[model samples]
Target: MKVKSATPVDIFSLTDQGDALAVRLQMLMPGASRHHRPKPFIEIAQSSFRSGHRCIFICSTGIVIRALAPVLRDKYRDPAVIVIDQSGNYVIPLLSGHEGGAVAFAHDIAQAISAQCVVTSAMDYSRPIYTIGMGCERGCPLAFLQPLFEQVCREMDAAVTDSAVTDSAVTYSGLASIDLKADEAGLLELSKSLNLELHLFSAIELRQVEHLLSEKSEIVFKEVGCYGVAEAAALCCATKLTGMPAELALPKQKNARATIAVARSYAP
Candidate 1:
């Protein structure tokens, strides 16, 4: 089968380890802007950070990677970053390798380009699971949040919920009530909240859940796919509350969605 064309929202300079790999990547993501070297890399990084791009692709050498790491960490809300060889032959998912989806992106790209994507996150490697968070910056709109999470309660009947971030600011454009069926991760702070749950599930396990949910036709998200920003919010809340390292669960495919959720323990 031909490689599926995937475009990076923001693509930085690439070494062109060789024309073959570079060309393959172009084919994968036809819309991604290209450059000869890493010159525009820094410029794009800076602009994309302030503009709220949560995911960035840095294709360069170890030196560039070192320089770009802190730049991304400091400026952006810890975007989902991917570092692939110029040849697109060897790919490395530096930060948020697992949760952020760097590994998945690399793997998918490698498959399309017929290259090698090296993804070895301890959690993913051991359990082979994929976690999805559900939310925007503060959270997703009540319209979507209400239905998606409510379904979980309708079927499960009883589920334990808590708010890890006590009084965590959950901003909403309209007036809403915290009529959740489950417990909050920390406390009932946000009047408008979601009926969400977090769990450390193996990708294999998630597939099962998706399949089971699909068979039963309980989840309306069959057409929405298993992974989305809403799923990212669930994963983010679950991991953040449980004191697990999983901030990279969602990619900043869009802006202010560029926002990051800091663990209450770590937040000021």
Candidate 2:
């Protein structure tokens, strides 16, 4: 599946405490909108839902539930719903646990606020979100690059299974590269084959992550204004997924036509 980017969040608050929490959320989540004491709470939530925004109610569950009852839709179609107390003591994911990432989002927010996260999803634990970054010559064949991904995943899976981190399986969240390769044929085909989203970052974004890479290349810097595409993209994507800088699980490995790197997130 093409995992979508984080959704725009709409936080509704009516009291001083709730408004304070909303301010914190604005800082924590980019593009998060705060609505303080809207006249009709239900209408505001419905509008946000219809517009594909995640709805977070910093009020009593009963009140939000009653207001959202009429707007409730299928889990896949409905926006994520989270409820938090005014004092920020408890954080609850009320709807769309996995499909909407309410559980994960709640955990991140709870951790930021030092509140207790109450996740009810069956598989509630957060795992590392691994990302693969690749750089290849124009028109490189998928046949040449496909086997490399399989090999990398096999090696990383073995390493993760042997580690003390949770025994749960590891999976690639997406593929990333420098913006120049946004339309590269081989990269697009590789992403399609793996059923993962492809994110392209600007040279500046990639350069910002150069310090985190296991290896840096002067040749690559002269060519693309960055030290390394594969390692830089992997580290950059990992940081985007998690709110912290990521560690390189596997440094850049290359064939005659392509280079690949892998990075994984640490749980917040």
Candidate 3:
């Protein structure tokens, strides 16, 4: 008898068993070209989050997810994450979609692979809120968010505190919109109502994007790592409303990729 080599598998199946194969095919397909075909996973995830891909499947072993996780917008980061076992079984819920379908995904994979489903934190925690506010606009990290927690405190002080508020005050704006790590009902709704955003703390500053959202020649939104999300938000909000960035007029950042981040969040 001949012995065969072992194939690398997701074990947990964060990438859908089929999803990973699909992603790989897209790359190998002959018709798919750079200008015509969609961008690769990293760029696609970022762009998808920016362009409003609520759920994304990452094929490669969670490296992309880990890398981008730190630099994505909080409110905007609700793409359901699943890890798929290469053998088409053992799907695992790595993050997102608490009450939504992610649990179903895990169960489906478990049933198929005859593997165990492990759900911690999200499933057990009755109330775990993640507030993904906007990025700080100055040239430094989005450290301004920590102090803004006082805003939430003030709301609590005013007795307007909500039962939904469950700590985890994370912000992300300099990063991509897809880094949203909370359930859609939690972070997405809060951002819409609170008029807030979330982002990460990045080495690439935000001096230029400030000039766009300016007031009378003086830059108003002047905080560090603030421009990327602002611009992306402008683009996304526009896309949702009409599917075009022309009306939003969000100025393009020089380093479009560097605009993403991961930070504590708050709303004002």
Best by lDDT: 2
Which parts of model 3 are misplaced by more than 4 Å? Answer: 1-39, 52-61, 75-77, 99-101, 108-116, 122-268
Worst 10 residues of 2 by lDDT: 1-10
TM-scores vs. true structure, each candidate: 0.44, 0.53, 0.29
lDDT of 1 at 160: 13
| Count of backbone collisions within predicted model 1 | 29
What is the per-residue lDDT of model 2 for residues 23-107, given as tens digits with 9 covering 90 to 100? 8877766677899999787888888877767788899999888888887877756667889999999999998765555776676
lDDT tens per residue, model 1, 1-268: 2322122345554444544455555554546544445555566565654443323354555644665655564311344566666655676766655434455555555665566767666543321212333333234443444454334333222211111112222321111111231243221222334322333333332332221110222232343233332333433344444444333322222223221211111111
- Supply candidate 2's per-residue lDDT for 3: 12
Across 167-252, the per-residue lDDT of candidate 3 in tens digits comes to: 33322222224233233333344354446653322313333222223121223224323444434333333233322111111122
Model 2, position 220: C-alpha lDDT score: 87
TM-score: which candidate is best? 2
TM-score for candidate 1, please give it: 0.44
Q: Estimate the TM-score for candidate 2.
A: 0.53
Error of 1 at 3 (Å): 8.6
